[model samples]
Target: MYLYFEFAKPKMKKKPNKNTHKIHNYEYYTSGRYIDYISRPSAVYIQNDNENRTTLLAEMDSKKLNVNLFMKSKLLINQLSEKHIDGYGFKEESKKLEGKTGLHKLFEKNLIDIDPKEAKEEFKKLENNNQFIWEITLNPGQLGIDNQMVDKNEWNEILNKHMKSLLKANKLDPNKIEGYWALHSNSKYPHIHLGFFEKETNHSNNYRQSGKFSSKSVERFKYLFENSIKTQAEYQNLFSLKNSIWNNRKEIKELFLSTIALKNKQETKSYEALSANELKILNASKVIANFYKNSKSKSYAAAKNNLEVKEAINDIYEAIVENNQKLALAVTKYKQEFESINKAKFSDKYSAGLKDEFVANEKDEFEKQIGNIIVKQCLKMNAKEKEVQTSLNYQEKDLKQDFNDDELPIGLSFYPYKYDEISKLKRMIRSLNYEFNRLSRSQKFQALRKYKKNISGVKSKVIL
Candidate 1:
């Protein structure tokens, strides 16, 4: 089970008012665990075989203390130091056992720094020095935790490392704060109780007004404790999975770069010379062009929402993957490793469903990355095609200008013919015009008369 945590401030009471209610003013000094446990006794005390356990009957029979104790620090320390609390006073493997004499002192922090008598006097001197209390509970039967797996030293170390993080998360200054914690070893669930307050009271508004630790602080500590108790083998498995994911990402990135390079290489080639995969990419580019024309945003997210754009992207992605065997192998290996680790660790139906959901999320992220790459490549190709078309249009305009120039004959004009035929026609027309201009007036007349005589001769022969 996951770690459970709860927080609270000292009990508060409403100020006396006849007409309107005022805010409840919290007390600075109160008995800590004894007051809480007596009010709500939830857990059953189970006696273990090896150790001399404290009987629940003794707790019920003990005289109760006044609810409103004036000396809060002394009462709090005495309650925390109680010997009958399970896992608090006794060492685990000690053979010298008795009813309650063999119990060890509870492990404590920062409390020993201040004398209880002096702390109680100091508490009385302050007006608004309220403290916050919280507890962390864990079940020993959980998969990653057990009685032997964690000890006082480990808990102390983990808490010490994250204490500052917790304080900062809750907007408290670590330097100004003083705190204490004690771990109680119940047979079913071991838990720790902690409380903290400012050493010298400051009337600053930066402190949390909610009087409770933030959820961020709770989650941070939970993660810290969970990671601390993880076994070496679990760490190795997690490291291997992360390495596989890194390799998979690298392979995908390389595949995208290579595809872009290939497109650039084939940009100048004629349509007939392109291979099947290249042709498919070219068609995909046109689809992407239309997508950009109609869509407001050219982002991959918007592209994937359109059916035509989605299919085009998938087709291009599949084509590239088919041709790149390394990428295919890397992706397959990553998925297999992920599933293998998850299955080995979690075998129940609910865990299986969670694993499936994780895999789907990973797949969606990968597809989004690949889709963005495809869109970029297609846009590049479309730009190159437009550039080539613009160049051809300019050349055609120049050719039309040459044919319609005033130096040429009036009947000569531009025609949509092959380059060679157009060049030959221009040459023939120029030559005939040059010869006609070079002839003198009388010589031109003589040539015209000769042309008419030849036409008349042909007509007479036909009549005959």
Candidate 2:
């Protein structure tokens, strides 16, 4: 995930000139005059101070700091040795396998000398548990307009400084968070890949026990890196020029707008297929938001009579039943225990409200009070119960060829005797499609096993 920070506009003139009746001279930051200002010699006069730092930030297309953070239980040595290190810009030409310096060398050079025997012994302690291998990418972008402009040696030095600062800020020891890093310059956006396995540090006074970066720490790292980059004279000027050119380009703006539209369309479609629990909360919220519009009387029964309100209640009830059986059972028990009391309470409230004449504001307040109770109950029951199932199975009937063919496929298959079984299978397939559409990329990746199995096979067939 990326972390974003809004840069402060210290140059912004908040007040207008009273005598001259002139507007605030906020030309340094305004997007409209940005192109014109940059084109003229006057822009050179604008000093690179705290005031225009935000303008520099605004000019950049890639505003947020990106850290592609990953943690795996498997060690990096095995992963790298097995040729499993794909997509991290590891080249085939420079690759070494047998008797070469591997991930272990990173420690010796950058942090500490980790003896192979000692490291293996330490790893054995948490061999079966979540012994993590952290893989991270920092500042995955072009150094300058032309990659040639950046000095590789200087860039590496600055990068190392920033990375160490980030680690120190997050309470990670350079020795403990040891990893191998390689800068891949072949790509347009030059990036570095860092890989390391977690080691138990006996020096509790120095290193963090977990050797982990929390979300908050990551956010802090993002800010620190951005500030560090800005503070450096070489990078600040290079990036400022590049970003101004990028943001002022017409094609970039058009591309961004088109991308945003497509994203909005996709999000709308996904939002339509919300989870049962989400739908309940959404419907309830809508009902509460529009409570004042309906219900002329201050009566709870009057508010309940509204179709939207009634539907919202029904949705909430269904959500509660589906989400939490225990909560539903408790409510069921409450109804049984205070059956007479609830009935009497309802009658009293209805009679009292009907008999008295309340103003529109009072009626609105009364409606809110009644709606609040129902919404609260629904919300209380809407907690998601953890699902621990490992597999999701769905069957597909192979209708590509003749069903009675002798030369058939080779996989376990079954024939359903009853019509309801076929119907159930169809329903299962439909549900899978619905879920696949609604789910995020990560969810789909996790559920790929089910899709891979269900998509290609048919029941009642076995051919090799």
Candidate 3:
């Protein structure tokens, strides 16, 4: 069992808090294992350390923190609305609850029907000076169960069952916590929102507060709610569907890259082993390859069948292994066809710098020219002898004399120490090299291509 409420162990000769003897228990499922989590003694203060918090969160991640479902749980304090009660009461806001079930108005008891206008008064009476509201939202598609599979009635049943246990863990009974809850199907994803006022300790006294919750209480409630989603085969199927849709473009790119490597006779055991990411990509790539083969007759029969794409990809790979030129050409041609399709399939943020086509080609040409120029420049510079210092002190004296003399060019001349000369020459050469490399391939090609443009006549400057 996991411990939701933690404690700092007592030190030597130190007595534990008497209140620590009591234990709080709750049930939740984690990593496919059903667990009954218990709380530490109430008197034991929780230790809050940044490093420890990070470590705990990482461990929670390993446990699949959300139980494969998404839950948004929060506490809202001092947010009162007359419309909130009216909406729950199915007033003009009845349209919001039209087809949804589990939508109802809550009361303090079986009596005292709190109207929309009296919501603030009733909430203030319960909360007194420390006023707040609590909210919980359970999202669908997070659980393996399809949102459509569960009808409105079944959805309400699930929410009520989970809500009871959640409130019980926090020392509040669902019957006692005056709140409004409704299941909303109008959203893209089905979810239920529960709103409630904080309960005060002494009902007769306004100053006394009770039924408050700790951060741990909130966490336990979340865990209890997530585990309520029953695991089924449909969950796994839904997960696969979501994964494929999310990684569609990514898989395509990886598959294409892998196919290219195999075509060039490169070692690809790493790709062959196929990690989860690579496998998805390879599957997409194979689908594209299969589509290429059937494109000749202007018929893409294989594209219509998702299952056949894998087999088709395999056939194309085997052909490439046998050095089939026709198949290679087909695959290459298909890659071009899919370029625009791929761009349209993904967003600009995801597809950024995917291809260097124009900019890249120009940058490559420019950098190559710059490298050649740098080599020639370096050789020319290297041919000259570096100034040698006969005496260290004598060199320093010469530099001081140069600096003192006003006869040197206003900005051109400076004291030339050995290091200064080396740095100056290095900076000039480095700057030229960097500038050339920095130019876009197109820019470099354009600049150097001009020299070649005059090649029909007397060679202007020999093209690098």
Candidate 4:
């Protein structure tokens, strides 16, 4: 799951600024004073002015500063670069524009070919008004990303790969795309700030014309990033867990089918004939029947929308989980492994809230899958039941028609033995009709022919 993944909306300006000023602003805010202000322990500073030199130092004399004034002073000084006597300001070393303390070097597709400072100047020289600035923030601690896991080189590679992907997603040629990114580490939550524009502007591209990045593009980037970061083992575990959940769902469906079959059997038997296990299945089938009766719509989407139907589905799902030990165990294991992976990637120390959100999201997805399976199975059973009922109705109609014969011997009642024989033949014909109705269509034609021939012989014998 993603840990505190944030894609800031792409910044667009109605009136473009000077390229020099834009590049400077992007660099200064993304990797310079912005980082210093957020990472600094305190805003309080003291100015030491003497004949020799003037230096700004972090204040050591806490007793001399008012806490309330310090906060208000910090708030008043919006720009961290601004000089302040009692609020946050860049230190002497931090003031150097070339210093890397708060400034991360810019990187591109080929790291060796581009010098960080020179790239900034080159980007400034680009004559494009359609340039876009994008920002992505990833909490390292939460993402289980430490320096050891992803070094600077690997991070640059990952960024480069995703940059190409992003360009292609926007319908721009990757080969012609020019972009630079800086991975800022000064803040607790490390982030990447990227600036890019097509070298040869493609006005035909919808993204360029609209000047908006699609949400699909952002989500794709996140997916790519997450996959790239996961270890092979982690990936395998996730794959296995997914398959297990699917298998469990299938098992639940089979259980429902078995219970449905048991219910059909019970319908044809007396209560005393049902064994304990059969009775249990019969009771379970009744619960399913109740769900169908109460549901206004058999559609899974509709069922989810209706609170009552949703609750009934959940209740049935929970009961199945509870009763089937293997299914219950598999479900428990899946949740545990899922939560474990989440915690490993997004440590609780940095992303407790995000971790919880991801876990809940996974749970919702699982339940939706199970719910869909149940709805489909139930609908299938309902269709089969209707089919069986229709066949019975047809059989009853055939029975009535077969019995209404216009050509019966007129004096059959006068001969008592002949009347009894004719009555026996009628009963035999009824039995043959029942057996024929049960036969397959292929077998039914032949069975009907045989029954007709037998009936004709019986009628002739009785008449004689």
Go through the candidates in order and give each one's C-alpha lDDT: 0.50, 0.38, 0.37, 0.46
Candidate 3 residue lDDT tens string, 4-96? 222211121223223224321111111101110111111111111222222433443575644212111100111111245455564644443
TM-scores of the models, in the given order? 0.39, 0.24, 0.24, 0.31
Worst 10 residues of 2 by lDDT: 66-75
Give the per-residue lDDT of model 1 (tens digit) for 307-351: 556666777776776677876776567667666655655334454
Where in model 4 is the C-alpha error above 4 Å?
1-296, 304-328, 338-354, 396-464
Worst 10 residues of 3 by lDDT: 31-40
Judged by TM-score, which candidate is best? 1
Query: Order the candidates by lDDT, highest first — what do you get?
Result: 1, 4, 2, 3
Winner by lDDT: 1
lDDT tens per residue, model 2, 1-464? 13321111224334533422333232322222222221222111111112233343343324342211111111133324334446444554124322222123343323222233433343344334333344455542433322222223333455566667666676666666544444333333434434444455535432233435666767766665544443343344434443433343333224333432343254332334677676455545445435644546533455443444544555544554445555445435433433322232212333334223222233344235434445444333232111211111112144323244244334323433223455456557756754554344335434654555676653211000
Could you give candidate 4's per-residue lDDT for residues 78-139 as a string of tens digits? 23455656433455523432222222333343333233455455545532334443334443
What is candidate 4's CA lDDT for residue 361?
65
Model 2 bad stretches (over 4 Å)? 1-130, 142-150, 203-212, 227-464
For candidate 2, give the lDDT. Answer: 0.38
